[model samples]
Target: MADPTPLSVFDDLRAESDELDDAVAELGPERWALQTPASGWTVAHQIAHLAWTDHSALLAVTDEDGFRELVEKALAAPDSFVDEGAEEGARMPPAELLARWREGRTALDQALRAAPPGARIPWYGPPMSAASMATARLMETWAHGLDVADALGVTRPPTDRLRHIARLGFRTRDFAHVVHQVPVPADPFRVELAGPSGELWVFGPEDAPQRVTGPALDFCLLVTQRANRADLALRAEGPDADRWLDIAQAFAGPPGTGRPAKGDAR
Candidate 1:
């Protein structure tokens, strides 16, 4: 399949958010306060973080200076800023929190659509095209939605939408090494993922000696650090590739203190 267009990714973002909304829309205050697998974050915190990030994305797309201020705040409180954002939004009544998320995400969709073709948008990390921004948002929604689903003792079936994240996980190979203070491999590693729909998604040289392969769902979970690698079904066929699995993270930040392996907590 061809790369997803900006409009298509924007559509996917809407769908992902809507699906999450369906999960949480009718929750009572008690349900909203239920703790999720994300350490201190509650169900409300998951949605609030999404809403807060959506609003931040909107500012980045529309107001570079404003986004810079947010970046400054993040720099000043690198460890606590993300939690702070989620906490602020989570404090609102559930109904208001939901409304804010809906409004902010809808506005972001509009802004992305109106953006001039090929224009770059400012971001917490590097500037990105509208399509990349939409894809990043979709990836986050799916990951956090998983936390919400787990909190509710439910499951969310994987979707081909994770292809974007899988692609990102592969593309960020060097980034993963860099963040871990490891030198990037000189040769590229091949990656092959089976999409949720069973479509083959391939990246890198077909004949590369180093390779990573897995269900797209597992790769997405691994790179997002939502599930511990030991609990996932991914495989790495080279030393560097193996190390990539150990530290892969698609989202920009300090290394995530990823989830513990199943049944092993200290």
Candidate 2:
């Protein structure tokens, strides 16, 4: 794998956000109220959450104290925040919802551009650099957008920018270890990803004997827990290979309960 380029990472984020905007705009009002594959979240709820998150990201970039206050506010808000947001959103015509989404996204874009290079921003979990925060926001939008598309039976095209999201999954290998209380292997392993666009993204040493490979979207979905790992064609070789794949995660916070492996469901 070549050295990970920062410029490429930024480009990936830009592309991912743009694609998500297009997908969200394409959904009709009926589809916006439709239930998504994610438990209890409708398409409107998804967009609302994304909008709320962008607001949170802005706070992270500009005001850490305010960000914490907002999280507390969300927690203190009505237990039916998601339902309320969805219902309110459902009442809006498609154009209105799309307009709100665009407005929030524009603010997020401005926040990303204005943030200092090394700024450490508060996140839903640990603090992260401005770049990492932007990356996280992009990943969430794309991953949730996938849920909306799946609910609507619309196929989203692959984008080169997914590589940015994939890189977050790669970096989270360490977080996964900490959450699972499993020690990561000190020995470096090669990571080669075939993205949704059929482009190969590699990290670690090119010649490293151990490797992880599969469809990029599947890999992203698995790491995000949007899809079961077994549904993906991921393969690992070497002593600790299987263990690493077992707990792969892309997001911060406590480790999630991964979906059951194929044929293992009750």
Candidate 3:
């Protein structure tokens, strides 16, 4: 069978939502307030943010005027908008918040499916094609899902779905450099990851001198800022590749302070 298409990325998004929901389903109120690895955010805040974004994404597609108003409001209070939204959402009853999240994601899925092939949707970062928007949603779901998993001390087994994230990370290599005002590498780095199923997933030129080689899960985690790059067994073969690993981020925003290596926390 062929690999999933960009449009099919929504299947992966649904899978992530299901897995994360299942993981958090049985938590009591105390567990809801447990802090995640994302500083200043509890488990509830994580889900709340996802809920808000999914709803915002729906607005972006179906109601441009409302979405623009939202953008203006967000810009007016740039630094605190996201945190404030999540904090406000956390005030809902835990079950209510979960229901709202489920509903918002369901609506988002419907909106994306109904969107035309070439449609572009505005977002907090860049405006995105329908497929790109879906993939971004998937990436965020997986990244925050990791935080929720960690807070619960649960080890969620990785799946081949990480291939989507790894691909996004590699494609964003130049975005990573450009955002930091660093010069984009003239030559692209080859990326070869051993997929969870043991298939080789290769990106970039096989003959490229600069290369990143590792397990797909590790690369995904590294790009999402969920794992410390130093702790991962990934190898970089050239100066550009090495520097890319040090600053690679799959999500948009200012450069992130990545997680610390195990046993190295302050």
Candidate 4:
């Protein structure tokens, strides 16, 4: 896989955001209010949550003290703060909500690009470099966009941009284990994914015994917890690679209770 610099990752961020914007723009009231696969979250909630986080990310990079204060206030509230914010934000007029999201993400992209070299930006979990932070934003947008797409019964065509998400999934292996309080694997796993554009994306040492190989899109969906491992065509060899597939989460935070198997309702 070709290395994606932070600057190149920003292009992916913009592209993903544009894709989501176009999707939401074609929706009407009924569709906007439709509940997504994420329990209790409507399509509106997903977009609202994306807008809210983009605004928050902008503040984190541009106004440290203010962002810190906001974070503190949010922490003082219940664990439902994020969800509550999304629910309330979703109540706005759809046009207004969409506009807010567009503006917020635009500002966030600017903030990230303009950040001084080597600057570390604070996040809910930890400070991240601009590239990592931008990739996280991409991952969130893609994951939430999947919810919206699923709610609409639409299939989002896979893209090579998924390389960023796949790389994040591999890079966050340790963080995933730590967040779940599972022992971090002493060994590393090799990830070899065929990108949507038919490019090969590889990670970890070539000699690693544990390996994951599959279509990049499937790997992205698996890591984001949007698709069940059993439903994907991904192949995992060795104990650690198989186990990681059971609990991989590209995003930071507690371990996610992943979606059920394809045919199961629960």
Q: Who wins the lDDT comparison?
A: 1
Q: In order, what lDDT does every prediction score? A: 0.92, 0.74, 0.90, 0.90
Clashing pairs in 4: none
What residue runs in model 1 are displaced by over 4 Å at the alpha carbon?
Answer: none
lDDT of 3 by residue, 214-255 (tens): 999999999999999878989999998999999999898778
Name the lDDT of candidate 4.
0.90
- What C-alpha lDDT does candidate 1 achieve relative to the native structure? 0.92
What pairs collide in candidate 1? Answer: none
Count clashing residue pairs per candidate. Answer: 0, 0, 0, 0
TM-score of each: 0.98, 0.84, 0.96, 0.97
